[model samples]
Target: MSVGDETLRNVNLVTMTDPLLGQVVEQYRVESLIGSGAMGMVYRGVHQVIGKAVAIKVLKLDYADDPEMVQRLVREARTVNAIRHPAIVDIFGFGTLPRSEQPYIVMDLLEGDPLDSYLKDHAPMKPRDVIPMLDELLSALSAAHAVGVIHRDLKPGNVFVESKPDGQKGIKVIDFGLAKQADRAGGSVKPTNPGTLLGTPAFMAPEQVLGTKVTPSTDLYAVGGIAYQMLTNHLPHEAPSAIEVLSQKMQHDPIRPRQWQPSLDEDLDGWVMNLLSREPEKRMKDADEARRALRRIGDGKTTGAQPVSGARPAVRTATGVVPRRDWGEARTLITEESSGVHDKPADVSTDRHVSPWAATNTEHPAQVEVEEATMPPQPAPRQKFQSARIEAPTVAANPDEVLAEVKKKESQRSLAPVALPVDAPGEVPVTVPPSRAGLYLALGAAVLALLAGLAWLLSQK
Candidate 1:
């Protein structure tokens, strides 16, 4: 009998029997069952004449009659072809079984473990390793987004870690079964029906969990989850049940990466948390932007360290300090400096110092607005004579008490003689002249008066 006839003959076989095994479909012969999932089974196949090996993913018999399921499988093949990224698995061909009418996809047979399995064996991957893997993943994602395809179900299991011949690590993003083409892309695939939750719970974005609109940022959120797992060996959200995990994802932001792995680089922690923002708009704008951000982090260029030149500077308070804006929602604040000087604003709360480089939504006042500096400003020339730096007191104090302390410090500073630097070599130090000392005392008094009046006005309010 012919190979086609043999495949047709096995259509009525019992469920326990492996019908596809050892059967020829198209130009390839099935050798063994590679793996199985809810919707399909993958088999290792070899080309009949050339002896070329490939993976054949066949739809399970249970879903053979479902047109929607069949179309979804076909769509996965089309989506992979549309995005010809090296980091994405390549689809070779798509066909159907002779009598069973089951759809199958032939694609490159990758030789590596899925990210989840690799993580199981060697997790808590170093930042150095995770960064490159994440870069490649994001590069693939950028390509998909550019083509208006969003991988609605991105997870570690779908990310394959391949071992390159040169002893370098590589990755391939697989399984576009749940991917959706954006409306503007002119794709014929119908939009997913509302109220259909389609992603892995632990990695689903808030909007995705709500079954609302899904965008490129939705995939970025899952990227954050995968990155979190790779770095800390833990999912961003963990609960007793999947439902609870979804609830937590919608209601709260994941703990910052540094909280789990204290030794993690601060730049990496910031990038990961930014990706995990509960609101889609708050996350990285697109996959390309995300990839660039990852590159910056890997290059030791910390995000939010410098301010974007054109961005609106933070609102300045009467005290010449920028007050913390209430980030009521879970979002990262990207602030910029309007003035040429790089001023380090101190938190009003006395206990802790808030780094301008990183800020998250927190209940405490220490949480400050941070800006991602896209374009670093030119460095200013060093000044010859700098004023003595005044540190904030450790204990919390009321506005009135704080003003009094500042006034006291100002008086002490004015009374102390200021040393002048000698311009020529081997020259002796010089103290501020009598006229300069008098002017300094008068200026100090004026500043103290202004501060006292401002304090009184604030109290009245």
Candidate 2:
């Protein structure tokens, strides 16, 4: 399925019941919530049997009954489980949660921040450090795609980096909930809803934005965007809606990294720029190619161009590179420059991120007012939900079903009282019948007989 970036708005995501775990499961003690998704809640759980800490992802009733989605999740999880790479998260097992009948996937508990936050915190790492991480990611992607899996949505947030057993940081890719096989594009069982976009727009490929057929190259484009962020701390273009952003991907050419850092080593800059090529063929085909390009640059052999120096004045490329900065970012940059701090641009050491200046799009009139007249309005996803940076299920479900489910969940949220677990199977089914009038009559007769016997005894006395 071609992934479009879906920025989720104000929708309540409900999970399925935990039947496998029942009131009690083997050794895994369900801890407090960690995070949530449209399908279910992720809990920090302890495995009692093994005496190890584990994480259990429980399916809520809302999504549990969705057999198709569940199966898809299962299939993807199974697929992911088969690939044991240092850079891919490990899927331990999948099974039913305790009492409720919903399914859950048990995975290795990890400690690390999302790549998005990681990138944001790390400002400009030299190519040496960045290339290794990129290499791991590319290898993971290559492994995934080789088995007919396409990580329809790939972004910094979906990636996880942890200190490996080998004393180096290992990157693990996560959230294959929205992943699709190479064969499923444009078929009846589409991943997303009709006309709804999937994937994160800011980093999505031009074809992905257009909802066109995608391959490994689609992911390559997103990696390219990551490289863009890595080198210059910004995205290529900014648009209002997913559709428009996609349009930019199709029609616009991104600003070459060379223009931003004239002093950048040529191979590194070219590697970054190659990922941004509008033509999939022209761009680095996959993560490994991109990684290798980075590696070559870090070695200083100059596989492409030599490094330049000084500001060459940001030239407006005829290739659709917009000089305008994203308003959200422009405001911040303008403030930073105007405040007299005039900080130097981040040097490459930590993958210093500078978000591209995106031009905001105005909402269409109908879209703006659709929920206004609705019976009762709830929150819709703003820009964030639209940014499909991770492998979220971009495949749209039936629009009517999705909307109905969303509304049903909303109503349930309003009507439900505080919940307490039933705990055991017998709790819900066990009940005592009410007393009957015949029982009262029986009690009265017994008392009368006792009184009569006492009277007989008194007479005899």
Candidate 3:
């Protein structure tokens, strides 16, 4: 048998017996198994001398003989120790099991469940609740990043939530097994092999999915995903497999939080979306920036009115809003419909495309009605030709001055013979007129004829 197969066999044999229970591993006694996973098991332990509670995470037997896995466990302990933040679980000691020689890390014993479980029980948490937790989480991340430690595997399952003595929730960032110490040059101190994907797919930044270099912003992107889930109770990207989820994340931006729950604050939606940006440069610069933005959002000090650059515009569908492309073309269709320029209203029933912001939900009857009812009626078309009545200047007025004034007025009127209101609010009206009203009309007709001929020629091509 291969070494791996033999190691697996040994692990199975060891599982049949509880050898570590009540045994002293290093300076702590292994009391009970708190959890078990593919990599290892976490046990509740107490210091032999101090009697202080601690959590000991041991490497699985199959990986105990693997030097790389062993080093990774040791690296996690060193990384946490380097980042001495209160919100981060402290690792005080590292050792190996006497019988199995399995590597183990002794860290603080957190009292509460992981954030994933808390989210499941109280998802769609209010901004007030989520903001504080995020603040603490970001604070911890800021400290880690300051010390050049990047928690590459930041996800809800790695975050612990415990109630503090002050009646506030405490956030503890844990499980830095995938953490890397970045060098001064911003590259990983120990870079992974090219094309090796790290971090959880659901919360990974696009850079992580692409197997490219990761920066502090990579962790912030995961924070955005977590914030999104906390507010919406749904992952940013949901697919059957991890590969599919990664693919979706690479190709598309997550649906805006407001679309999932409109009652959410706009600034909160923007901040989360900003963090979830696919490009690292587009996301918050660091954890400090993210925390500050969160505070501003919570305080209503900033308006998130400007759409995030490079983000996919939300598509307006019959049922509800979804994230998609081709928004500009869809919006043009809405403007054309509202203008009444077409002899027959374009058959939107068969045309799936609609305005990105229009209420045209075809899937949900109730939403469609609500949107349609709230839509403002198109304004009446303005008169194209307003009589330019001119009055004779008083005889006492200088003829030269009168002539100059008349010329100025005529020039202004000729320039805007066919001014039209823009579809968007707050935009200046566009004019398509000439010097004289009659001449302007003639020019407009010629222009229209030319455009029609050009369009026909292109269609034939």
Query: What's the CA RMSD for each of the models?
Result: 19.6, 26.7, 21.5
Best by TM-score: 3
Ranking by TM-score: 3, 1, 2
lDDT of 1 by residue, 112-179 (tens): 77787688778889999999999999999888888889987788778888888898889989888778
222: Cα error in model 2, Å: 1.3
lDDT of each: 0.64, 0.55, 0.65
TM-scores, one per candidate: 0.64, 0.61, 0.65
Model 2 ranges off by over 4 Å? 1-26, 165-167, 183-196, 258-263, 305-461
Q: By lDDT, highest first, what's the ranking?
A: 3, 1, 2
Candidate 3 runs further than 4 Å off: 1-16, 185-191, 303-313, 316-461
TM-score of 2: 0.61
Per-residue CA lDDT of candidate 3, range 1-461, in tens?
00000111113333336788888877788887666666787777888899998787888899999988898888888988888999988888888777788988887777766777687679889999999999999999898888888888787777888777787788888877778888752344433755356557678777775566788888898899889989977677655545545655664566556655657765676678778877787676788888987888788676434333433345432213333444454445344543543221121221232221121111222112233323333323221111111101001122233334445544553453554568898898776644476888999999999999999999999
- Looking at model 1, the pairs that clash are 306-373, 334-371, 335-371
| Candidate 1 TM-score versus the reference | 0.64
- Candidate 2 vs 3: which has more TM-score: 3
Candidate 3 clashing pairs, residues 3+ apart or interchain: 318-361, 318-362, 318-363, 319-363, 414-434
